[model samples]
Target: MQTRRTFLKTSGCLAAGALLAPNLAKAAKVKDIGIQLYTVRKEMLEDATGTLKKLAKIGYKQLESARSDKGNFYGLQPKEIKKIAGDLGMTVRSGHVHIDKDWQRSIDMAAEAGQTYLVCSSLPSEGQTVANYQRCADAFSKAAEACKKANLVFGYHNHEYEFDKVDGKVLYDILLDRTDPTLVKMEMDLGWVIVTGNDPLAYFKKYPGRFPLWHLKDMDKAKKESTEFGKGQINVKQMLQNMDKSGVKYFFVEQEEYPKTALESAKYDYDYLARLDY
Candidate 1:
């Protein structure tokens, strides 16, 4: 039987020794591993095609692109990026972008890229009051409607600031309570939730099935920066155990600031996740 590993070993693109010994088919291993391209943005900026090939080699089966100075796909058109990733045996499931006046264009690009979700990276307007969040919720609902027209789901990715209090209520809760769950899905960033003194498990309990996407980042407790999986304060293994409760369908590995080279950190994360059983 010429398995994928055997084929890769025979083809010379993959070294037999470098492969992770545990097969993904093993029970309890995460079925689909993904990475947010931002983790390797520098490499992409230098050589997008080369970077993607490296990621595919690293065993990232799915990707979520981050908007860069070059363009949404490091200057590659939507269809171009889609084709490139397809050839590499990976899929781009989602991306981060601002909900702005050109949002319609963003929708068009996501549709062209053959992505399932288009996430608003942050609040389009400024103001942390309840009224502001309500207004943003209204806007996001509208944005979701537009995304539906393009056959895409609309979502939001959170940072630490969303946890800040607006009056007596948590601003993030406002966004959740106000938005129509069917229209707006939240991409909870687990690391930010922990670093800011919030509990992701509680959110799962509070808003069951509201989060469909995730940025599974690990954070350093003291430095509050991203660290290699096990070295960080975050309990990556424990979080994976609760994926069902969080309603996560697609989670991407996101490391913002790492101690080693970005690609090295990414590789370490890849191995750590591959070893995880939940």
Candidate 2:
């Protein structure tokens, strides 16, 4: 694996100002900057080739796949998408595989995509009760063990629902406590955490290093959905400052929908990260 400095140079994304600016005095050591492909689902489904090339040009060296409308890597199949990622000098870190009958196929797809991690972004709605939560946690524990055997990391993505109290304990707490930390990691979504009335920084502090991945998104202060990075309520700089201690490895910029074009939205995010000294 290339150092982030080398990767940035090779990807041709050294910010014009960063070219002259001194090294970030207190910058956290980030391993990779990725993009959640779901942010540009429309363009991806319509023009996978062109869209991917554009993302690569924008300095996205890794991708986190979302389930397509047709399911399975925007209808191109797993191996095909992997080839595209490789050709573009990008890696597919992980993908949101729907929990379904084809779950085994999803694992195979992850291998095909050359992904080191495979995640289930959501849990089934049916099994959300206290009893179900324990069972689900156990299931995830088993899955994590299986992933370890396969030489892959398995993780769960979070939303507000996890904060709901179950038997006097927050469901998220239960899941975290019960699951084997070594086997199952977390993918923190800062925006959703904020939306649900929790503090992102608090979690980063409390769960130092438990999160290996994150969905980099910003929440609109006045709006309900996601917006551009700096224009949102989330203090991303503060979040980044804590990442090193938080053990976050890779974070993917993800804007579900934006007022402007997806590329433009992503550029704004990149610019913000680049401008910050930390």
Q: Pick by lDDT: which candidate is best?
A: 1
Model 1 lDDT per residue over 7-97, tens place: 8778675454335434444338775789999999999999998999999998998899989998788888999989999999999999988
TM-scores of the candidates are 0.89, 0.85
> 1-278 in candidate 2: lDDT tens per residue?
89998988866765755664554444544435699989889988999878888888877888999888867688777788888888988988888875667767777778777788888788744555777777778878877776676678988888778877766877777777788878878898888888878886777777766789999888885676888877778887778877777688889999977887988887777666656655
Clashes of 1: 0
Error of 1 at 209 (Å): 1.0
Candidate 2 least-lDDT 10 residues: 23-32
TM-score of 1: 0.89
Q: C-alpha displacement of 232 in model 1, angstroms?
A: 1.1
lDDT of each: 0.89, 0.79
